[model samples]
Target: MKIKNITTFLLKVPLGDQRFYSSQCAFPERNSLLVRIETDTGICGWGESGQYGPGEPVATFIETVLKPRLIGKNPLDINVLWEDMFTGIRDFGRKTTGIEAMSGIDIALWDIAGKFYDKPVYELLGGAFRKKVLGYATGCYYRGEDVLDYKKSLQNLKDEASGYIDAGFTALKIKVGLLHVKEEMERIAAIREAVGNDIILMVDANHAYNFHTAKRIGKFLEEMNVHFFEEPVVPENIHGYKTLRETLNLAIAAGENEFTRFGYLELLKNECLDIIQPNIGCAGGFTEAKRIEALASAYHVQVIPHCWGSGIALAAALQYCATIAPSPHTAFECAPENSPMIEYDKNVNPLRDSLLTETFNVNDGFVQIPDGPGLGVEINMSVLKKHLTKT
Candidate 1:
């Protein structure tokens, strides 16, 4: 079937009391750009763009630019369509809104192809390497009002950590780099004590530190047995990543900020990271993400995708994760450290929880990959309209 029309929805939900802070900035509300592609034969697919910035620009780019070229094309020609979209913005749009828009369209196209073939998106990708994947709760952000009150913030963080454990999550990731190194250490210490040694702990600095500071924090993380340190330095600092990987005992993970296979090739070539965290919504969707995964495999690096958007993005990530095999196959049972894991954002996001007809819930630290056609989760259009942002 040929493509018919495309529509865009910009959804925003205020966090009100749930407002929290990462090292870089405060998240007062969650924003998402949902792209709906309808084919002439009456089949439709949904995809989400990265919420890194305002959704208006990406939506406008999709409508005024990409949509016009894709209307009469075959949805199954994903690589050709992706190339056409990429070449048009190759010089200026390699990283930001340009690729982000392409990502949404590409994912929608994959969804359409899956429905047409009567298979799930993972089957279209290849086949499932696994039917379920491990999940790590991504939360424990600094409370907006409690940022300055170290004691209150520390207590809040500990409580949050405990709550995740109670909710059946064995792996947890917390935000660092917002407080002083000493204060952050205290918070980590408190969390470690609260969760005990069995829990798998990780930390993200969100590029808040320089080389020296990251080294210092990395040392502490090593002592605490943290699984990985994410975005310790900025994405542009390849040398910083390499040095951090060489010096630290824990894994250095970065790439949610990276674009496609080309950008990922640089990181793999430099041996900068032990793990690459590409967000499916931002990294050119499954078409490019599969390429990135292949490149990472060639370099003997782990691929654990980053997921922080709506349920559509989460479902897309789950499908992608299902196809990722262990970096190096072994006869031994797969350990938690060696197995593939997907980020399950535990932050307050109504769009993530309620936007889908079937919400993805983690059961005992693992999530079942959707087995139905396409991304497998249908959009709740009523919920979509409720949070629709006119812009």
Candidate 2:
């Protein structure tokens, strides 16, 4: 029906040191900025935006600035709502923290539309192309102290990777680019050996290197049969990505840091990457992400969807990936191998686990798609209230 009200919450979730990569050890991550959209018909939709940049001010941006513009708008008119949100702030232009605030509302609107149509969000978007998506374990990071010894790092990787393998994950991603090339190489080699040649191994540097270093690391990864190298260089350097793509034999993946389809167009034109990783909550939700997927498909790019936030972000990404067809070639930058795995965060979050009445389950490396109306997961308001912070 019509929109009734909007609410926003900045929820902070604590993670165990072992739950995330080593670099994030000191910080208690703010994690997710949660949004709730209520419709007149009593249907509610849930969405998330990562609580990055500045602080809780993002919540204020959504409520004071964006919410007033969205009231009484048709939740089903996602395209119109997205355009209104984008154009309303065009003077400020795109790529602002404001876009991140709009992202949460846009996602909630899509979730509402799915509920209105009495179908899962993917079904409303044109039905699912795959039932279950394969997922990769993504929290494996260096666990060494300031000493930075490769021995401890290597053992930590083996021990952590083996846990994921034992948990039935078919693929796992580790953080790289922090240590020397030789040390990074040894770490990857050890994980590959520990998991055997069958399991897929992906590495992300989080934009920690230069073009020369990416090329050097890419060369080594090619020899190791690394599935993909993510954000090898800074995110702004699409040209560096092109050079790395041309120089390296391994597949290149990025785009978690990218905003919308417009940003992705620059990457696609370069033809440097083979997989495109669009974060549903951050990159303009299902509305714009699906559009980006279509653009990537024309160039024959695969979409693995970068998801590193809370459960709402994970569920939203899964809904989009379930419906978008995989390109004949791999996705642009961060595509996984066969079975089309999604990125799953193994970190701690009461919202990720307890917010939903039924938790999403992973078995044998693949996660089944949600079948209920909307995002297919109901929000536990009690849990939300328990975790919500007062302004």
Candidate 3:
């Protein structure tokens, strides 16, 4: 079917007293830019462009520049359209902004493909490797007053970890890089003590350190039996990544900011990291992420998709997790170890939990994959209207 109409929304769900503070800064709201494509045959598809430090850049770019080019193209010719957009926007956003917009457009096309063929996107990606995916709660951020009070911070960490455990989550992730080394250590220590030995914990610095500090933090995390060190250092130095990997015993994971296969290829060629984290919504959607998985597989690297957006993004990630072949490595396995577990953001978001007809059901820390056509998420227009507000 041909493309008919395109719509965009920049959604921001206001934060409560428990605002999420990451390595960069405190997040005032849970924000994401959603893209919807309606086909000529009356079939429609949904996608999301990841909203991070920058606000609404992709949505505006898509609406002003890319929408005209995509108006009449065949929804099934995703590859052709992707390339057309890739080369056409060289002067502006070929790799960075270009791919970010194309990511949502490509995902919408895949949704159309799945709807037309009466199959799930994972099946269209050569079928599911497993029926369910293990999920990890990504929370434990430093809150408002907790940021200033050590006791309050420790209590917040304890409460967050206990809540995850009580909710049947076997794995959890916490924010770092915003605190001093000692404070970071204390936070991890408290969480570990609270959760006991059975729970798996992961820490993310969000690219907050130099090579030396990254190495030191990584070592500390390893002592606490942390799953992996995420974005420990800035991504500019791929060679530094080699050094970081060698200096630390824990797995080195990054690539959340990276865009296309070429960007990922640069990381793989340098032996820079052990795990590749691709945000499907930002890394050119399923069309590009599938190629990234293949490219990483050849390097013997594991792909643990970085997911923190609307349900559209979560659904896309679930499709990727279901189809990816299990990693042979120690910590990033799929079925048994739940290696590269789905990064389930524990933040407050109406788009994540209420925008879909059937929200994901997380039970005993394992989330069963959606089986409906396309990405398996049926849009809830009424709820969508409720949460629709500008950032």
Candidate 4:
């Protein structure tokens, strides 16, 4: 079937009281750009671009540039379409907004392909390696008042860790690098005390530290038995990543900011990271994510996707996660320690819950893969309208 039209929705959800701080910025609101592609055959699919950059640029790029090329093309030829878009923008749009726009359109095209074949996206990606994947609760962001009272912030973090455990999450990731090294260590200590030893704990610095600072923190994390340390240094510092991985006992994870297979190849060839976190929505969708996964597999690096945004992004991640083969496969690959995991942002976002007709809920530390066709989740148009903003 031929493509008919494409629609883009720029959504913003105010965080108000839920405002939290990462290492680099404060998240006062969550924003997403959703793309809907309708075909002449009456089939439609939904996708989301990454929230890394401004939504308006991504929406505009999709409509003004990519949409024209895809107007009457066959959505089933996803790879060819992806190549065409990627090549057209290779000069100016390789990294951020250009690829991000392509990501949304690529995901929607995959959704259309799956529906056409009467198969799930995972099956289209070469079938499921596992039906469900362990999910880690990604929260413990710094509060506005966190710097004012150290003791109170520590207590707040402890309480938050306990709440995630109560909510059936066995794995948790906390934010760091916003505070002094000593203060952030105390926060980690508090959460570790609250969750105890059995729970899996990870920390994301969000590229806040320099090489020396990250080294100091990495030593402490190794002692704490933290599962992974994410983005300790800036993404540009390939040498820092290599040295950190060599020095630390913990896994060094990054790549959420990375663009495509070409970008990922640099990290892999350098032996920089022990684990690579590629956001499907941002890192070229399923088409390029598959390539990233293969490239990571060759380097023996784990590929655990970084997921944030609305349910459309989450569902796309879940579908992609289903196809990831066990890294360093063993008979017990089904175990959490051996298998890959998906990041489940625990922060408040109505877009994640109310945007889809059937919301995804974590159960016993795992989220079942979506089984319906395409991304396997239906959008609630009313919720879309509620959060829609001018582009």
- Candidate 2 Cα outliers beyond 4 Å, as residue runs: 16-27, 51-55, 144-147, 329-339
lDDT of each: 0.90, 0.78, 0.84, 0.91
Model 2, 67-182: lDDT tens per residue?
89988988888899889988887777377477778778888887888788888989888988787888888866655344267775677778888888999998888888667888
* Candidate 3 lDDT tens digits, 253-320: 89998988989999999999888999898888899999999999999898889998888889989988
lDDT per residue as tens, model 1, 119-169: 999998889988888888998888856676777667777888999999998
Question: lDDT value for candidate 4?
Answer: 0.91
Better of 1 and 3 by lDDT: 1
Those runs of model 4 whose alpha carbons end farther than 4 Å from true positions after fitting are 144-148, 334-336
How close is every model to the real structure, measured as TM-score? 0.98, 0.93, 0.95, 0.98
lDDT of 1 at 275: 92
Candidate 3's TM-score: 0.95
RMSD of each: 1.1, 2.9, 2.1, 1.1
Model 4 lDDT tens row, 123-167: 999999888899999998887555546677777778989999999
